[model samples]
Target: MKRPAGMSNQALEFIRTASTKASWQEKIILLEFVSGLRMPDIVASEFDLSPVMKNEYTRLLIERDSGKPIDLIIGKKPFLDFEVNIEDGVFIPRPETEELVENTLIRLPKDPQIIVEIGTGTGVISLALARKFKDARIFSTDISSRAVALAKRNAEHLGLSDAINFFEADLIHFSGSEILKGKVNLLISNPPYIPSSRIPHLDDEVRLYDPPLALDGMDDGCSVVRRILDLSIDYLSPDGLVSLEIDGLIEKPLNSYLSQSTLEFKKGVDIRGNLRFLYASLHENSFSIQ
Candidate 1:
């Protein structure tokens, strides 16, 4: 069998200079991942794949040099505790977003709770929560149909189909009316918060590949978040908690919004010490959805 390409001195140099701004460990990881050639394969391909003609390896090098993100090139990203499949259509889950899932789980009632996640991009957050809280029934929604399918596939792949239900619709639109209505003990979302004007400034991988709706918020980057806050009063159980991921820069605006709401709320920072999540709950168990 013809051997696949090895990491050439040229390729190594190419990667080194290409990713020089990135740390040494990062560059090594990027090279290994982007080429899709394993260590042994890389060692063997040195002879056959060197001075490459037009092929996948050549394309990977070119793209890497051009600043295409390795995850997008490799078509997946490791998020939370799972390797999530990714494509150009969905939002790439970030480590900071994990804060929403972790904090929400910490605050959930120990007894069985109906937990619903809005805008479940890759099902990363919801799947992790379901695995962590085996006693909980988890339901998730996405405004993008492609995202919904992706989330369902992710759930099924992770053997979580029995524990997680998937739906397609805008945030709270489908959530407020159905088996999910007024019974949810917790609500979680990582809605898009990149203000429209600023979305264009995002990295090419994000601006060019990820779904715009998953990144671009309206003018203030709060359209979807504001809507979610509005519906939490009607959709969440009295004792239910709502946890949302937000841009740290908007802490003051978000705090002001929660101030006027009947629910009491708190914000928490991520591992990077950035304000990343909002936790809100009604004042009492008697606070029914009226």
Candidate 2:
């Protein structure tokens, strides 16, 4: 949707200037990009200057002038056609992750597929995929119970509870296999792939506000990716597909690794030209279970 008119550019500029020395203004912009929340809300509830009784507008101006990440202040983010609940416990969903759903939808077969999404997060990916593939039975899992509940809430709020099954599992480590093993026609994942060392270098909003588990990927940063690939082989149907979202920087290494696998895999780029998706097929030409 187009941004609402009458949002004072002057106010935004003031906030920008206020946070000049810090990265808070950039954080606000990023939040706006991700959540679609306006400057009014940012200044109103985020910094809590609107109802302060005295010097309200002045305080709002001062806070904007002081600089603070809007997500830190506003406390939520929107993603993939839905307003996903966000907290320090969860990683805010990104635009590139949406590409994983878009590309997977493009390659889906005519019949139903038992789709499983690993690391469901705020359940944005699963919800987006479920919305697109309405007939597909979606089972979404995450390690965090809070995230699981949040996902469930989002699904029910979107009237998608009947279409999805929510589970709390540690990246396929839980008893999820009882219902998920060898049953998933398609396995989709957006695993944590960021390197441990790089975590400190990320933007303040991400480093400070997003969950660490959602970003850290061990020494070489492929720990979660490798685990997903290794564990998924048995879960996939004979000709079922596995789609993954990975860091573009590791595309070369991942591609080289996938080349040696029995499964055939291909990469897809997102809107920003990032190699955001990895599509793998167990066998060519058929999506049916064998």
Please, what are the lDDT tens digits per residue for candidate 1 over residues 1-290? 22235555655555555543455555555456645555666676663233443255556656656766667767778877788777668888887877677666666654437888889988898888888889888878898998989888888888988998888988756644576667888888999888888887988767877789888778878788888888887778867888889886566666677678877767678888887877777754322221
Flag clash pairs in model 1. 6-42, 6-45
**Highest-scoring model, TM-score:** 1
Q: How many times do residue backbones clash in model 2?
A: 2
- Model 1: lDDT equals 0.74
- Segments of candidate 1 deviating more than 4 angstroms: 1-27, 30-54, 284-290
Q: Which segments of candidate 2 are over 4 A away from where they belong?
A: 1-69, 286-290
lDDT of 2 by residue, 133-171 (tens): 788888888988888888898788888889888888877
Clashes of 1: 2
Model 2 vs. true fold: TM: 0.76
Residue 3 of model 1: what lDDT?
A: 26
